[model samples]
Each structure stands twice: as C-alpha cells, then as structure tokens.
Target chain A: MLGIDDPWIWGVYLLCIFSTLLCLVYGLVNWNKEGEQEALEEKEEEAWEESEEEMQQKELGM
Target chain B: MNLLLLNIIILIYLLATLYLGYRGWKSTKDSEGYLVAGRKTHPYIMAMSYGATFISTSAIVGFGGNAGLFGMGLLWLTFLNIFVGIFIAFILYGKRTRKIGHNLNAMTFPELLGKRFDSRFIQYFSGIVIFLGMPLYASVVLIGAARFMETTLAIDFDVALLVYSVIIAAYVIWGGLRGVMYTDAMQGTIMFVGMVFLLFMTYSHLSGIVPAHQALTDMANLVPAKLAALGHAGWTAMPVLGSTWWWTLVSTIVLGVGIGVLAMPQLVVRFMTVKSNRELNRGVLIGGIFILMMTGVAFTVGALSNVYFMQKLGNISINVAAGNADSIIPIYINAATPEWFVYLFMLTLLAAAMSTSSSQFHTQGSAIGRDIYETLTHKKGGKSILVTRMGIIAAMIIAVTLGYILPENIIARGTAIFFGLCAAAFLPMYTSALYWKRATKAGAIAGLITGTAVTVFWYLFIHKAEAVPLGICKMLFGRDVLIASMPWPVVDPILVALPMAILATVIVSLMTKGPRDKHLAECFRGVK
Candidate 1:
C-alpha cells in the first residue's frame, strides 16, 4: 500500500505543485513585458500596420 | 426538478453563442480574417482559445475515467500538458510558427508546411489526412458531452448527440475562427470555475487531500485480481517497469499525448493567430494554469471518486453508469454535487465539447476548403470561406455518423489514436520545416508517405487492440502481429513510427537536394 505518507508519492505531488507555481509566478511577473511591441523591419512594420488597420476597419464595419 | 430552468439557461446560452458567431461572420470580410482571426488577436483570447481547444470533454470525462482505473501516475500527463503543450509550445514552436506563417502568408498548418517546402503534394496530402482522421477525435468529444447530458438530463443518448452536433456545426460554420475563439474564451472560463468547484467539493467530501489519498491508498488491496494480472500495482504508485501496464502507460497514454501535442493542427494554428512572439509568450502562463486545473483536478477527483463510492456503497468501482469507465465522472457528479451546481457543470461540459469540436470542424473545413481546393483551383478570398463553410457541414455529418457507431471506451483510445497518428505522420517534417534548413521536398514526401503508411499498417494489422478489426494478419499469417516475441500490441505506433519518420527524413535528405538557399533564408528570416 503506497499511501500519502510515502516519500515517493509526496515527491510526485510536490513536483506538480512546484511546476504549477513556477508557471503562475513567471506569468504574473512578465505579463506586461511579454506583450510589449517588438522592433520590426520598416518594410515589415508598414505591412503589419496596414493589415492591423484593415482588421480594425473590418471590425468597425461589422 | 428545475428542468424548465435548465432548458431556458441552455437556450439562452445557444442564443449568445449564435450572436457571437454572427459577429464573427460580420467581421470576417476576407479569407485571412475568417481562417485565422486576422492574425491580430489579443494574447488572452489566443490563450483561452488554445487551452479550451486542447482540454476537451474527453480529457475531463474520458481521461478522468481513465484516472479512476490508472491512479495518480496519470499526473505525469498534466506535467507534460503544461510543459510541452503550453510552455515549450508557446516559447519554442509558437514563435517560429507565427513568424514563418506571417512571412509565407499561410493561413493553415498544412499550408504553412506546404509553402515552406514548396510542395503542393505535401499540402494536399496533409489536408486529406486531417479531413479524414479528425472526425474520429471530434466524434469522441461529441459522445463525451452527450453522455453527460444523457446521464444528467435523462435525455436519450442519440438525441443528445444529435442536438449537440447540430448546435456545434451552426456556430463553427457561421463564426469561423473568431466565433470559435470568442465562445472558447467564455467556455474556457466556465471550465476553469467548474473544475475548481468540483475539486473543492471532492476534497471537502473526503475532509482533505491527505485523508482522501490515504483512504484511496489503503484500498490498494481492493484492486481487482484481473487488473493486477495486467500489472496494476496500486492507485497511488507507478506500475512496475517493463510490465504490460507500464508500456500502455508510457507509450500509449503518456507519450502518445505528450509528444502528440506538438503536431496538433488545431492547437498549432492558434499560435499563428496571434500577431507576434510576444503574444505567445504572454499566453504561456494562462495556458499552463488552464491545463493544470483542467487535467490535474480531473485526475485527482477521478481517483478520489473510488473513495466516495466506497463510503456510499461499500463497493469501490466505477460501475455506477452501466460499468462504463467513461461515465464515472458524470455519474459521480450526479451523486456528489448540489443540484444547482450540476446545472453549472453541465455548461462546463458543453463548453468542453463545443470548444474542441468547433476547432476541429474549423480546421478540417479549412483543410478541405483552403488547403486542398485552393491549392487545386487557385481560388482566394470570400469564396474560400464559402468552401470552408460547406466543408464544415460535411465534416459534421461524418463526425456525427462516427459518434453514433463508435464502441465503448473509445473516448480515451480515440483521442490517443488521432494524437498518435498526427505525431507519427506530421511531426518529423513539421520540425524540419522550422529548424532543419537542409531538409528536402523529396525527404518530406518520403517521411510523410512512409510515416502515414507505417501507422496505418500498424493500426490495421499489428496494433494488438486493432488487429482483428481489419483481419489482415489473423487470416493470412495466423497471428495478429508479426513480432510475436515483442509486445507489439502494448507499444504505441508513435514509439515505432515517429523514429521511422525521422529516419526516413534524414536518409532521404542526405541522398537528395535540400531547400533552395533563397527559400531557406526567407523561411528562417527573423527566426532567431
């Protein structure tokens, strides 16, 4: 009988908790920074902006 | 009985979903917008949509049922889901996929690969496989949700399945990716809350996690003798290594899903929906949390249900719903949760089914409409959306047919089979297209053909569970599998076929010409 008192069982549970907390902390700390704009080539930036405008216009039309 | 209230709530939910689909329809003025949400979607929407699509009712109900039988070892899948399915996916694959998709103006996963290799054959081949293979997965999701309704609402199973199918088709055909994502975000939230409540209720019922697990572990002797023969050690412990149970656990269940996540067309396309790598990075944590709650709680609750059943009936078996393991969670919910909360959980189940099925339908539709037809006819724009809509209807019909006919315990196996198939067939070429500049078109085609061929051959002839279905080996060779000395039946096709695929890619690429330097430069542009 492998019970909750078993060290191996506790190890598994702890690993899960540790991994989940790591994700949560990392996410919260870097949330804003991650979605910040990245530098793009001028040519690529113009094309991206044009598409973004098109998307906005289409949404407004809807 | 609150039946009328349930109906009204369900009706209102349907109307809201339809309204969202209509909004998506209005905004979808072109092919790019319809297929990929204009590729400018917010990180939150992308994350929720990705999470919801990945963790369907099958994970909650079917795999939850599986957890009841397999025990805590299944938590390994949750770790993989967060690590591989979310973090690695978002950080590694998502960045490259989005950048290359933008560079190539590719709208679908197969198209992304096809354009990368400059091979129309790769495009059409992938499209056909997705159109054919995805229905098995989608139908299982449909059955999972319908079973919940049948058990909870007392509706006939067939009727529940039909109604569910029709409603999902209505939204997916109308809304495209935008509609799917919008509803998925809403659905994802419902799933998160519902699972959290179920977890708390479970722990509170057993007093606490420690007590619940302790009780479950104490009942290890209660494991059926037949299961013990198959190498089930105990609920709280991993199976004995090199045992048949271990093979099934690692090869079929764990690796089949863990590695398979990387190649999923529906999940992969979500990476391309966002604008930049930043959006993917932002999505990583939310996706991880969503997967953790969705899968972790389900597995825990599943194992603990044995304790609940034991306390209530002096028996510890998932036999409440006619001995079907798939119904363990649904039946448990009926016995455990308050009536009002059951109604809320019903929405959660529906969300799980619809979110995943809609993505499948949408992807399959796009595969046929954009990847296949557009590749052949060279049509573009609003016309492509029309073709996709038609394809959605076709896909729904096929999935609904499969939903009606599939066998018991098909939920977990069906999900695994599709994931395994995708991993075997697509992962090698897809990885090379992103990272390996020396990969050739001939190598990709060889890997694709050989990989798909081997998986089909294995599933039809050699796979122990599936051997008799086709009856090729049983009739001709007087045995199910040629490798009688090895545990061919227990080993997953992915364990066999994925390596073969990589081998095929490497050998053929070494023998043939590689991608053009200009093409490689363009594909790898800004990739670092």
Candidate 2:
C-alpha cells in the first residue's frame, strides 16, 4: 500500500544477484597477483578437499 | 487509562509472583536446587524454559514493531529461529552440551568453560565477561516491557520499569533458578495465549487490506521519495537489493541472528539443565512450536499494520513517532487496535520480557556469583546461597540502570551483541571440547580471548553509530580502518573472528600437550 511497485520486482532482484556473481567470476583476474595470496588459496583448497572426503566417508557410513 | 483495572492486574501479578517465590524458597535447601533445579525436570518445563529464555520482550516489542517499519521481510528471522536457533540447537548442540555438563557436575556457564579446558582460569574469566556483557542485554529487555506498559496503561516509563524490575528481582533473588524456570513456564503460557489473541485481532483490523491497497494504488507516484532513500521499491514487497536496507537485513539481521543463536550462553546453559541427550532431542518440537507462534504471529500482525494505518488514517503508511524502533509495536497496538486487546497485549509482552530477562539475570548472576566468585576469589563464603541471591539483586540493579538510561534500537541489535559475543567467546571452545581430543587449555584461552575481544571491537566501533553505541568506548582508543572509509562498517565479526578462533584453537591445541587434568578422560565417556 505504501507503493514501492509490483511484487515481481523481487524476482528481478534475484536474477540480478546471479548475474552479479557471474560478473565476479570474470572479474577475479583483476585481484592482486600476490604470491602469498595464491599460496594461501592452494593450502585452503587442499584442506577443503580433505575435509570434504572425510565428510563423504562419514555420510556413507550413516 | 483505566487506572483501577490496570493497577489490580499489576498488583495481582506481583502478589502471585511473590507467593510463588516463597513456595520455592521453602523447597530450595542446597546449592544444587538453587542453580540446576535438581536436574530432574521434565522436557516440557525445560523446553518452556528454553523457549521463554530465548524469546524475550525484545522479540515481541522490538522485532514486532520493526515489522511495521520493514514490512514482512523480518519474518525470515522467525523462520531462522525455529529451524536453526531452536530445532538444530537442541537436536545438535543441546544433546552434546547437556551430556558434557552433567558429566562435569557443572552449575554455571563459567563452570562448563573451566571444566572443558581443565583451567579454572578460563571458567573464572568467562564468568567475568558474561557478567560484564549481559547487563547491557538485560537492561534492554526491561526497557522493552516498560515501553509497552507506558503505552498501554499510560504509566510513566520509569515507574513501569521499576515495578517490573522489583517484581522479577524479588522472585529471582528468593527463588533462584528453579523459581525462575517455574515462573518462566507461567509467563511463557501468558505470552503464547496473549500473542495468539492479539494476532487474531490485528488480522481482523488488517483483513481489509485489499480495499486499503486499492485505495493506495490509486496514488502510486505520490509515494514519498524518502522511502526510496529508505531503500524500498515498495512497502508490500521486500527491500531493494544492494541498498543499505538489504545489507542490514541479510548480513546483520538474518545471518547474524541465524548463525549467532547457536552460541548463546544462556541458551547453551539451558542445554545443560536436562538429564540426557534424549531430553534435549524431545525439546526440539516444543521449542519449535513456541518460537513459531511467538515470532510467526508477531510478524504477520506487524505486516498487516500498514494496511490498517493506511485505511484508517488516510495515509499510505504509519511512521514510527519515537526514534527507538522498540516503540513501533506498542504504537501499532495502541493506535489501531481495540482497548481490550491492548491490555491483553501488555500482559503478553510482560510474560515475554520477564521470562527472557529472568533467565538472563540468573545466568549472568551465577556467572558472577558462583562461577567467578567461587573460582577466583575462593573467598570461602560459608553461605553461597546468600551470595547467589545477592548477586541476583546486583544483576537486577545493573540491568535496571541500563534499561532506564540507554535509548532503544531494534531488539535484535542487543541480541546480536550478546549472542555474537557468546559465539565468539565460547562456540569454538565448546565444539573442540566435545569432539577434538587435542584441545588444550592454552588453545581455549586464545580462542576465547581472540573471539570475544574482536567481536566487541567490531560491533561497537565498525557498525553504524545510528543505533545505540553498545560498548564502543574501548574501540575509541584502538584503530579501525573499515569505519574510516565506509559510513558504517559492514564487517560482521563472526565471519572474520569465529574462523580465527576455531583455527587458532585447533592449531594451538595440536601444538600443546593435551589436558593433564584427571577428569579429562572421564568427560569423553559421558555420552558413551
């Protein structure tokens, strides 16, 4: 009643969020090329994989 | 104001509370009864206590009123509460916390913290932090209930606060934790029934929304431009994305409360109250239902208030007169609803506020009296019950002072500060204690210190100055880079601080020798 607009505007916003995330993927190269940051990412990737595998095994048992 | 009826209701409520306290006083003979309610409570009572303790006057008055300002978008928080805060908390955290707590024979939060780390220092320090932090939270609950009374009965705000405070303090001081839980059950029932009735009334008033919206849609462009600046394309819908409204809604309100609730010290202690993990598993349904009604109904009614205000007042919407968002729910209740409904809503709010406040007061009081006082000073008091009762009085005074003095923000802001602090302070340590065999005392100390300090630093210094400055004095001397550039900092500390605490606890615990305490191995066998 306060007159913002159609309820479907919410739908447009949700779509924009997806597009924004896609843009961020394309924009990732613009981030600083620091070696330490790269190393940190690789280290985190390994940890993530290990944790993921452990979790999968736990799920299989359950 | 119908002074006589209001007076009689308040007086009778007060008298009943005192008599109940006296009855509890006769039964309480030892430290065990005072703190843990003899550990033989039914799931229903414990569930009510858990629900009551979590849903406060802040939720009813502060968040309810916010629905008037924000539309129904805030309903997400209620959903988060039942699903994440209540269901998962009991189903996952409660079962584990209660087992560990019962194994340790812990009575207070600090005791749990201390026992977990094999460090009396950690427990004692945790107690100090809880005592220091909780008054700010407790006082807001007092202010919320007082605001409702002031609006409904035409009572002075100060007078309402004092009356409510005295009644609660008297009962809590005399009766201790069991008395608090008994009254919480009574109060929870009052809140449940009252909110349900008010929701029905608000719906009837707002049911005419189709007509009202038709009337307002007639003048769509005439909508104020300021609201666009207020970050909405329209009131009937959610906030515009990337607006300040969206950020606060998503980052702070929804995510903060959703993730943050899992770590609340008062709630975590509720987990410790029952006999077994099964009791906790049972509490999930009970807590879920209570949260759904208390929160779901408030938001539904709040969203409907817009239609009511627009139709009756010939305005497109209602603007909150007071700067404090806590006043919004009271304003809607008073302005548009029938007078009889107002009285009932007041009682509902009193129940909501008192139940939460008493839990907070006792939790904080015990944190100071039994946790820190017994652990550090080891003053060897002959009568600990006397000290515990006095601690309750002191806690009441601190909360009373804060409630009367501090201005209101939305209730969620205070809730965030306390729960955020809890999550930062205790969550990582608790997780490790339950499952990670390597968790050391030093690692716990790091996690607690790093998490708590960083959370306090961020919420106070980085967040906007628009709301009340909840403990920013310390950050004034310290530096903040994020606040310098942005209007307000968007950094929610949990995203940053929590992981740091977890990582630090794990890394440091692995580096150090496991706990040397004799009780350490026995604790792991508790759940087994």
Candidate achieving the largest TM-score: 1
Q: Per-residue lDDT of B267-359 in model 1, one digit per residue for the tens?
A: 999988887776776788888889889998998888888899889977765655557889888888888889888998999999899999999
**Residue B311 lDDT in model 1?**
91
- The local lDDT score (0 to 100) that residue B527 gets in candidate 1 is 79
lDDT tens digits, residue span A1-62, model 2: 22324554234323333333332332243222221222433454356446544654564442
- Candidate 1 residue pairs in backbone clash: none
Name the lDDT of candidate 1: 0.85
Q: For model 2, which pairs clash?
A: A4-B233, A4-B234, B65-B329
Best by lDDT: 1
Which residues of candidate 1, in runs, are more than 4 Å off? A1-9, A34-62
* TM-score for all models, in order of appearance: 0.94, 0.83
- Provide a comma-separated list of chain B TM-scores, one per candidate: 0.98, 0.91
Interface RMSD of each: 4.9, 17.8
